[model samples]
Target: MFDTEREIIESKIRLCLDCGKCTVVCPVAQHDPEFNPRLIAQRRLSQNSHSPQDETIWQCISCYMCVERCNYYVKFPEFIHGLRAEALAEGAQLQCTHGGALQALQHMMAREDLLQDRLSWLPQDIELSEQSDTIFFVGCAPYFDIVFSDLEVNTLKGVEGALRLLNRAQIPFNILANERCCGRDLLLQGDREGFLALAKANMQEFARYGVKKIITNCPECHYTLKVDYPNVLGDTGIQVMHLTEVIAPLVQSGELSLGELEKRATYHDPCTLGRCSRIFDEPRQILRAVTGLDVVEMEQSREKALCCGASPWVYCGAVNRQIQDQRLTQATATGADILVTTCPKCQIHLRCAQKSRDGKIPQVEIQDLAFLAARSLDIGGESVG
Candidate 1:
């Protein structure tokens, strides 16, 4: 922890007494010993380790399990994120493949051609509430990129479904067409300046748009806006909500029926939403409301759920693949056909991992909750027509 950058972040590391509890509860360590949160915790505790070059740092899936499980209340994820940020700042490069992903994020954020085109996924018939109180701040992810190709068109079905639910219930909301990346990836990757710039830009946009409250479909975006934004924006008087929480009430009120899914399903808790923000029940409740579906629980569910392996501001492909495989293996063991997740990042990355694997491992379906809700739109369907 005596590293120049480590000491700078030491205030946050005030009292991590080498308790291996972080290790015990960490899925990265459980799935692969190469990743030991306790060891990282210990290194963070050590005062002499200069220029540590551990590949395991790149292996962290950015899952907040260690932080949540830490009895000492160490913000382990923050520590890890800080460590990664230091590495990037020092020009300490990981494999180029993962680095390239960061480059792609930079390119995406800097280019409106990529950003605006993705928004086309929304059904033209779907109404855009430009003057509403809430804005669903969809993050940049491969899932939404595919769906919203015309502005996330392929994926607008989910957003449209939620909007329909809101509209049917008369909830006022709108969207920011000029919204940029939430800077989560950059922030996690140790690009402090980059992150700050993106955050400031977004904060300005939110203020300009009169975005009193924000709802996000991506846990990473949700965590960035809800948890990190305030520290930088100085109390912008905005609220950040996960889509599940926003729509869970609708399902509970019988306003959004999930329709009948005569199949077994399991839910994957994204680290950003579940551990980062303590959001576990909302998504589960949304799933439970669906008719004819058996919601099975994997050995690791809720706070203990394994990470989908592509977050925390960096993308180490090999390690992430390992984590994703372990998660998929565990998910497959539950005998569930559909593995539902709320975060677009988790859904897209897991889908990429699922496609990378060979056949016969339960054709696990990965979908966002909004897709199911849209399918249950008893009233919105006629309106879309």
Candidate 2:
């Protein structure tokens, strides 16, 4: 166990220039006056004392906004990640959203004897190539469908859409027969051991199937596979790609032509794909390719895109709802017929805000980019929708 506290203090927190910019732009600090990134930094560096158990450590939604605005490139979200790990190391219990069910599921997936019934939801029409080295990393869509059933969130729509598009284009790809969660939430919630176990299991599966490349629609899974794995485990010699990266180029090259969709839509940039990975254009490119679909931009988009209120599935409540409502309001402001995003979690959280009985939040139609695209795809020279 590395000294997360000491490392964060020395490498990131201590580099703070006492600038209050992080707090000013932080969504949490903006709402809760008690939370300040600058103050947190000061406390960590205080000669008197330091405590990772501070509530502020878990309040961060891990939006990467601080990293976006920091002049010195201080990774505040990452600092909190380290602090959360430190807190857990000291036996501090963290409240995982969804009653810690999702976290527990990830832990269970790490077990060697676990058998994953991951393919029951897969439709028969989308054929898989057993010989293909490229695999569609489904992430936790199957489990999410069960967990968020109350919200009626169909995360598998995106996965099915991805498969449909790939099949339409005659792209050979396979799905993991026994896939596991990417452990992004676990890692972000400071469960390093859990994350490593999942990572190890995933890596073993990848090697077993000779998976040289991964294509996933879920932004969190894409980010975890593409960036987080390499960062924590060194080079695993794999190419990780978001579904947008695959679809956009095919559309642009005229290999895949999308049918007309007479609807106005606004795109939500998933933090993982846009801000973190700098993948701003690929989704937009595919969206723009569809005929009759009027694309509108939200006021805060691209680098300044608002997060969908929660991440890593922990401690989500008022602040998360506020952020989600704010984002939904922005999407509504564009007069879009639908709010399209690449992240399934974004689809859920944004829609969850609209479900509130208070009716204060706007009830905008939310669709995953892949699902929307699949509905508009021209397969067999006929429009699917």
TM-score of each: 0.86, 0.95
Q: How much does each candidate deviate from the true structure in C-alpha RMSD?
A: 4.1, 2.2
Worst 10 residues of 2 by lDDT: 376-385
List model 2 lDDT by residue over 1-385, tens digit each: 3457664864476678998899988888877888898888788668754543587788898888888899988988888888888788889888877798888899999997778887898887788999999999998888888999888898888888888888887889998878889988888888999999999899999999999999999888988998788877889899998889888999999988987789999999988788888899999999999999999999999999988888678888788888888898899999998999989888788877888735777877888888888888643222454
Residue pairs clashing, model 2: none
lDDT (CA) for every model shown? Answer: 0.70, 0.85
lDDT of 1 by residue, 1-385 (tens): 1243553365256577776888887766765777787787577557864456556777666677777777667777667767776677668874544336554655456443433544655556556678777887766653456443432223444566666656656667787876778888766666667677777777777887888999877778888888777765567688888778888888889775566667788999888788878889998888888787789999888878888877654545666777778888888899987787777667666766766675543447776676665555453343321
Candidate 1 wrongly placed segments (more than 4 Å): 1-12, 94-102, 107-118, 141-157, 255-258, 312-318, 378-385
Q: What lDDT score goes with residue 55 in model 2?
A: 77
Model 1 weakest lDDT span, ten residues long: 147-156
TM-score of 2: 0.95
Which candidate leads the pack in lDDT?
2
